[model samples]
Target: MSSITVATWEQLASAFYQHGWVWLPHFLSPALIAALCDDLQQQQLRSAGVGRQQDHLQNQQIRRDQTAWLDGSSSAQQDYLQLMQQLQQAFNQRFFLGLFDYECHYARYQQGDFYQKHLDAFRGRSNRVLTTVTYLNTPESGGELVLYDEQDQLLQRLPPAAGGLILFESERFPHEVLPATSERLSIAGWFRRNNSLQGMVDPGT
Candidate 1:
């Protein structure tokens, strides 16, 4: 990747350690990012969760997010699998096991679309440890991924760029997609560990 460097990754991870998140600009190679973006545009999408804010703000509509883990489509699934295998070879790769279930979502924020600040994990489901987002198509205006700490201090900003990817601990401090003046496209998912503690859902709650 032209924009992703180990030095950059190190920088990103370092920031994540200190503040709980980092915007690793252009982590994926350009060609791979392009392919993934094209594939995502064609994939099915859905609202991230309940989709309603306390004050009636609606989250972005992902009418075309692909559920690669469950889909019968083999091409993209195979591609993701291959990428995981390659990532395994890298020394800096953290998760010892392959990725758990994942999703590729296409997000288009109309002029008024917004997502409330929230953590990615749930109360009674399988826990997702690491949350990673890859920017596929970023509009010229708005749509910033704001990183916050447990103290609710805004740490840094990650403007959108195709081929840009950001990774961080999902179970840590809360994060969110800021309201966008235009449209935004991204793929967000998690990488699981080999030994996921069973019954963590209830206990963690």
Candidate 2:
């Protein structure tokens, strides 16, 4: 990926703060996108789970995307992580969000798979503060991200275009993935604050 400048980071923060979500279609370099795509194909993906910790379960009616966590085991993954770290710091500096860490995973949606509208975080029950998605491959049709406003009204329908990045406030908006007519690949991630119960940190999924 190309070098991410401080100005670019500021722009991302400003846009996200004002609009509640930001979509950048040319955020990543082509080489990096290709490398991540290749890595996703080699990884073993499992049915995506809903809810958190003990409440987690796979409900196909609500979601059918498969996923594999990005463990920073490869160069491409490490690079991506570095980019997120920069964003995390930028967020803290500009918004005083106190974001502690970021976690992301590869998501694969096969033909006919979809996820119903849902919020990534509750108002105070979770640590996830912001959501991020980067598309690795482009599908000919379908597989759009439908984001909703606070009142559950339509906000935007984002297509899964390669090299595109989507950022949104986790608790403020509800979103869903439409069924794909072909295989769709992307990375879904979250920026988290340290929300611990007793001494244990909240587990994010």
Candidate 3:
């Protein structure tokens, strides 16, 4: 990926502050996106679940995508993680968001697959502060991401575009993935604050 300049960071921070969300086109390099796409194809994926931990269970009515958590096991994964780490730092520095870490997973939405509208985090329930999605492949049609505002008003409808990224406040927006006519590939991630109790660190999903 290319280095993000200070001016670019300022623009991103400003846009996020004003809108609580931002869409960046070609935010990642094509080579990196290609590498990540290749890595995703090689991984073993499973039916995606809703909620977290024990509450997590597959519900086809709500979602029908397959996913695999990224582990930084390959060079491509490592590079992607490093870029996100820098992004986390940038957010913290600009917004004082106190982001402690990030976690992401490769998501594949095949034909007929969709995820119903939902918030990524609930107030006082989850540590996830920010949500991110970076597209790896561009589908000709279908699989658009629809984002809604606090009043449930339509905000934006984003189509898949390789290297494009969308970022938003996790708890403030409700979003969904539309059924795909073709395959849609992307990385879904969250920036979280440390919500550990006593001395134990909170477990990641």
* Predicted structure with the largest lDDT when compared to the true one: 3
Runs of candidate 3 exceeding 4 Å displacement:
none
What lDDT, from 0 to 1, does candidate 2 have?
0.90
Tens-place lDDT digits, model 3, residues 1-205: 5567787687788899999999988888999998998999899999999999999999999999999999999999999999989899999988999999999999999999999999999999999999999999999999999999999999999999999999999999999999999999999999999999998888799
RMSD to the hidden true structure, all candidates: 6.1, 1.4, 0.9
Which ranges in model 1 have alpha carbons more than 4 Å from their true place?
1-20, 51-77, 84-106, 122-126, 194-205
Error of 3 at 122 (Å): 0.8
TM-score of each: 0.67, 0.95, 0.98
**Cα lDDT, all candidates:** 0.58, 0.90, 0.94
Error of 3 at 124 (Å): 0.8
lDDT of 1 by residue, 83-186 (tens): 54344333135423344444334455556566667776544434556677777776897778887876789866788887677777776657767777776767
Worst 10 residues of 3 by lDDT: 1-10
Top-scoring candidate (TM-score)? 3
- lDDT for predicted candidate 1 compared with the true structure: 0.58
